[model samples]
Target: MGGIDNQKKFVLDWMDNHAKELSDWHQVIWHFAEPAFREYKSSAWYVEKLRAEGFEVEAGSGGMPTAFMAMWRNGAGPTVATYVEYDAVPGNCQAATTRQEPRKGLSKYAPGHTDPHSALGMSALGGALAVKAAMERFGIAGTLKIFGEPAEKVRASKPIHAAKGYYDDLDAAVSFHPAYMLPMVNTTIWDTHCGVGYNYIYTFTCDAPQDWIASDKYSPIPQNHLAARAPGANDALIHFYTLNESLRRSMLPFTGLWSFNEAILTAGQATADNLTPQISQIDYMLRTDSIEQAEIISNVMDNNAEAAAKATFCKWKKTWVAKSRPGLANHAMAQATYDNLILVGAPRWDETAISVAQEIQRNLGLAPMEKPFLPATERLTSPQECERLMRKQMPEWQRYLTSDDYPDYTWHCPTVRLIVARPMLSAPQGYTYPDWVANALGGIPATIDPMIQSAGKTIGATLLDLFTRVDVLEAAKVEFEERTGGGVGGSKWMAPLLPKDFKVPHQYRWPEYVTTARGEEWTIPYRDDE
Candidate 1:
């Protein structure tokens, strides 16, 4: 094989040549701004593009209509995979401007890229394509897979794919996200990685209204009179919401951090006439450091759901949306990626980019600095140091603080989680800017392109190194086997937390755009005025 340095240069040069196309791709996805499970157009665009580039594309993998897998193989060797997410948040819709403005002809609350998975996904695409170019040119032997993961806002898809054996046989995996909260320009999460999380949608249906009323034989009312039925699904929903809150308070106190959050899906059908509401759904997600804690929380939630159903005279069922495992750290992989990051360097803010950020700050009525981003964005922090800083704010025993489904990929194979900087407006030293400012910056090309390009180059270089340098791949695999007992089938390894037959919750009433007489509209209809 040729020297690793030559392969790295080939990949970097490929990225440089395709930079404009990558930027355009990022723009299209940012404008698409489709939300979870509803990324139909976005998915189709990716499938077409990947196929055109000679990838063996599988659309609608894992029973998710919008999820896909793209693969390119040359000869035979280690299989390295990287995944992308295209889902946007529900209520963060903002246009690409310095001020807070919704997209033309869309609801102010329509979906937008908050973490801006647009850049996240496009960068991964650029990296994969660049690596593909390198492999073909240099005769590097390996298989590269790019998985299209949808519904990541709800931490969905990855767990399902893993359970269904899509992630099996992977030598290593790379995951990337737009950095927020953590200020580091480029770093992989060290310890205190994301914890186990469970998401479920509990549905209550009042199908048989007659069962709620007393028997006619024992009733004193006239024969022609209509008997009053129970309060129906609305009452069931209220009962569940209240009881869930109470149960949350009753959970055992521990030094580790945990959280239980709920979002109501179905309250009641719109109606003028007096009739019992039929269906109500409440979605609950819990994150904890261990499976034991998640199970405890899950059991209590189930009990509360049953009691609520019994009391309100409704039938209840649950749909498991996501069950994710805590991340397993690979210091070997972290060091390897960090080395590539140092070589690639953090994103350099050109004059135009700096001007755009300063303008954003000026619009926010805050004094703009010469440097619009936090100082941390221009520097690098070791993974160990990042973890130390993160833990300082948490209890000593809190091994898992936040939650993401990427951790599930770690259990199956060595996965490196890379975070790259996305620009944030510079405010006065001790001041804060509004979220819309950051959201607005995410959509602006002048501000976000650097992140996209830098991440693409770094990831592309890392992929090339992994494929061409056998020692680097072996180092990552050795760490993986050590942590996972004996690799995938090891004694200490945990099987997928989900059952093989676990039904995908695609039928749930997730937010999506709709078509009406007025043309396409968000689920929460947009108003031209006010």
Candidate 2:
């Protein structure tokens, strides 16, 4: 109930002054809505802004085209790091409207921010800028590294950055993700943080269709219906998919919540070719609570790929995409972030925001509530409570669930995972709201600005605390060292899952907006003209 100190006040006031700028930046990214590995415009904008702020910027950091690293320093002090994610999810192109509508001049199935990375990126930027303001005014000494990470939905860039020594020199890290679940609305991860994830692509190739049978000796024409054609890459992909689907149950113990999903990157898609569709690529990403479980499932998948390739007379190769280790908990860092979150308080919605939620409910043909926003978004939830809610649905022995690349930084330095409130609608019993409602709210300034403002202030104050409170930072470091054996090289420490010479799987075709003779349109057209 008391007032905040002058330094924290200064940080909060900085956030207030720049709140509009943050909202506008969020709008820019929401409109861009570029999906994984193709965030050219979003990354360029961040690089330009960081360079203008007097930070040394690296355009392409970690060999990922849309990933970057920027640093601002004030003499010699502790080096703390934070990162931004801008890549939107594919096939979720919802416009900022009460109804289910896509952005103007784009297809309905184009990319949009499902997790609303738009707010996440802008809030972090506002915080970093505010931190810069405090450092300049109070003459604080430290380093701030703002990483531009792309393809976070696929968990792509961070692991690569960590493996390449991007996070090795950090003293601590601050990570922010927009809240998703109800009970975890304004809380950070506790004991069982995100787990291990493995992403790999199986490429099947058919080089010789003629080698299936001695066609030349029996018949002169090998391409006609007179001879049976050899099973090619398409069949290989089908076999791989079906075979994996069949063996999915036997791959691992059905103890914890694990998942295996595949997306066909390139397989006789959008075209019916007479030829043997020479090449096909399918992506598989699975989540498990432990690395040992991940390894078991991955081994089964690898064997399935080989069998499918052999059965279809094709050659198959597995390419590494991403691997994220289970997150390590730092009680000290957690306490620091929660303290700052308390200082900043939860995001409060205005009547205008409530009206917007009601409008969305009406558009969905559902009755609206007097207070349409979910209660959790307006109140704080402690870390312990959040951990309880997170594990309520999991089995007892499972240590982790889902997966996030932020854990990669935890293995290197004391890292804090900050979860802030994002607008979510409350629904009537047995009635569900479409995902577009949340997506639309994320884009509207009235609904999303409060979240951005509070998150920015929390981040600014927390970073300022690390610079000023040596005891807290040291305590976090000690806790981190104790967890990872002795430190980075200590026992029980986990190294980067990626190999030294791992190549990024960027050569495959990914969906993106394109400009042609018609206009700037989705690569796969779904409009009336088609």
Candidate 3:
């Protein structure tokens, strides 16, 4: 609990030797910058890389074309796990430069890594591979598995993996993410863990627009205002979104951080005239502190869709994007990870990293200070303090406060959600920075490598302790069992939110890059001819 062991040292040193390689891969993913459910190049590179490392790779593990699971075992021992998420957010295409601009040769609407999942993926890959090397050199006995999770921004993949029993055999899971906002940076979660989220799509079709009149006895003139064509899909979508917004307060108590947001996947399907705008799609993603709260919000949404469809003479169907469980706390696991984090210490920014931050400030028309990054970004927050700060606004009875699908792993086995600081700048007094600032910082190698390097070292150290220390492993298992009321199949245990036979909604129209006559572009422009 105090100092690093010889075995742990091996993995940390492993980070030192392979740091550049990991950073190089980070840039590779940044350049790929593929959107949710469309990480073709990103996922393929990871698959090939894992195979080259002698992993028994499953290219499409959970029936997702871009998801993968790679495993390597060394004799008989405890099996621990970790994962990589490489999906980017669409419309976040700012380049990794001081000025606001899209990456070269791409449109401003192209997908980009906002969370900079680019570094998140590399951090875990570096950690696991380091453990793999240490396993051989130190004759450590255990199994190591790394999952390639795609479409994380959509909250996809992991729930499917959980239902398919992919996580059923694991003894532990270590989750690493870049520090997005407060208290979570450089700490493990003690309590007040991540909340639950539900994502769904409502599709409306105006198939019977012509039958707006009773028995279709009335004649209808095409493309004429006098003809009273049915209100159509576009009108129905408007009804649902507007109705949902009106009832937003009644859907929940409005006492905690609970809300739903929407995205219009397709509005009029590019229909030029009043061919009744045949179909439309809208996506809703809601997060709450409890499954009960999620259910409360979901019911209102379903009813709203029904009413909206009926009013506009359209029929609709609901498609689930993802249904994720709230994270369960494992004090033993949290403590172990925090101990390792303290050993690694906080991320240290050098002159180069600082200079990049200063450039960003200057571009924003603010005077750059000697230290541009937030102090919290570099300071360590203990697990207890994180919980206290997280619970400050919530009621005493509420147990969770945020949202993520990673919690799905906690139900199956012990999981530790780890975070290392990505470079977050300290703004001038009363001047808030724009999102593009953070996005740009994430992509620049000089600024982000410090956080990436820290994660690799911290993750490797935690995994090594799990493999070699029986006491640490058993303690985690004990806490996990207690939380789940005897673990996996117990009375308090919650099964995967998505059914085992649930189909992934990859058919939805998500923004993606395409190869054109010119070359690969963000999305092809509208065309009349093939």
Candidate 4:
């Protein structure tokens, strides 16, 4: 193989050469703005691109139609994998301008990138392609795996993939996210990592509408009378919703950081008939520091669903959408990743980028600072310091502050979570810009390109090192084994929380864009004339 330095140089140069291509890819994804599990167009584009780049692409893997695994190997060595997330959040639809305007001809409730998975996915793509180019040019022996993960906004896909043994063979993996409240210019998560998170959909169906009136078959009213039928699925959904809220406070200790939030996935379908409403769904998501805690919460929620179903004369079925373990720490991988991050440096913003941010501030009626970007964007932060700062705000008993599914990858193989800066306007002292301002900046090329390029280079360099430098990969493995007791089957290691045959919940009635008689529109339906 060529010298390590030469390989690194080649990868960086390749990334620079393909900068525009990466930017264009990011733009396309940003424009698509597809939401969880429903990212059909976004996943198709990635699969097509990966295939064109010579990777053996699986358009859908792990039973998820929008999830894929793309592999490119050269003579086999350590397998290094990176993942991409393309799901956007609903109600974040905003144009790429400084003003808070939704996309043209789309409603404000349409999905848009809040965390901006567009940059995140593009960075992973750029890194993988750059590393592939270097591996071929330098005769580097290894395999590269790229995963297209969908529904990340709800912490979906990764757990399902890991449970089905999709991530078992990897020597190491890398994950990335755009900087939000935290200013992670060039840093990896230190400690205080994410905890266990669970997602479930309780589907209440009134399929046996006749059963409701079975006990009163001899009532004075005729059997076909609407009054004889029970209050249907809508009542069951309301009871479940109210009962779950009432039971939330009893699910976990208030001392630690834990939460339970619910969303009504489907209420009764639009109907004017007096007939009983047939179907309804409610989704519940919870985050806790340990799997035990998550289980306790789940049991309580299940019980509530049963009671609600009985009272409302409906039958309910629960589907596990996501179950993620707490993050595992790897010092060796973190140090190696941090070293590469320092080499790549922080994202550099020029006049064009700064002007866009300043314009956003001005539109928000706040005076633009001389430096429109966050100071952290121009500096490097150690993971240790980042963790220290993060922990300071967190309560003493809270081991994990937030929830993310990436931790699932850590148990199977050593994984590094990389955080790179994305541009955010530096508001005037003691003032805050509305969320749309940040969302707007994420779609603009000038403001977000620095982050995309810097992250791509950092990821590419780190992946290249693991491919060529056997010692670095071995060191990461040693740390992984020690932490995981003996390794994959170690005593301390935790198995996937999901069952192997667990069905993927992509078929659920999730919110998505739809075509209506008025024209194409969001599922919630917004009229342009309104």
Tens digit of lDDT per residue, candidate 4, span 1-530?
23447779888888889988888889999999998999989999999999999999887899999999999989969899999999998888999998989998888888999889989999999998999998898898999999999997677799999999999999999988888667345689877778998999999988877667654545544335435667789999999888887777655456367888877888886875666788999888888888877888789889988999999889999988999989999988888998888888899899998888878777777877789887888788899888888877877777776888999999999999899988866666688778898888889999888898889998999899899888889999999999999999899999998999989888888889887687778876554456
Write down the TM-score of every candidate. 0.95, 0.97, 0.96, 0.94
For residues 1-530, what per-residue lDDT tens digits would candidate 3 score against the true structure? 24757888888888989878888889999989998889999999999999999899998888898999999999999999999999998777888999888888766677788888999999999999998999999999999999999988778889989988999999999999999878788998888777888899999998867677643335435455556578889999999999998878665566477878788888875747646878999988888888887888788888999999999999999999899999888989999999889988888889998999999889888898899989998889999998888778778778787687899999999999897899999977788898888999888889998898899888988898889989999999998888889999987899999998888888788878778796776663322121
Two-way TM-score contest, 2 vs 4, winner: 2
Deviation in Å, model 4, residue 289 alpha carbon = 0.8
lDDT of 3: 0.87
Model 2: how far residue 167 lies from native, Å = 0.6
Please write out the lDDT profile of model 2 over residues 452-506, one tens digit for every residue.
9988888888888888899989999999999999999899789999865667776
Tens-digit lDDT track for model 1 on 297-384? 8988888889999998899998899998889888888888888887877877789888888887778787767887777776777787
- Global lDDT scores for all candidate models: 0.84, 0.86, 0.87, 0.86
Q: Count of backbone clashes for each model?
A: 0, 0, 1, 0
Tell me the TM-score of model 1.
0.95
Per TM-score, the best of the predicted structures is: 2
Q: Which 10 consecutive residues of model 1 have the lowest summed lDDT?
A: 218-227
- After superposition, the stretches of candidate 3 with alpha carbons farther than 4 Å from their true spots are 1-3, 214-226, 252-255, 524-530
Worst 10 contiguous positions by lDDT, candidate 2: 268-277
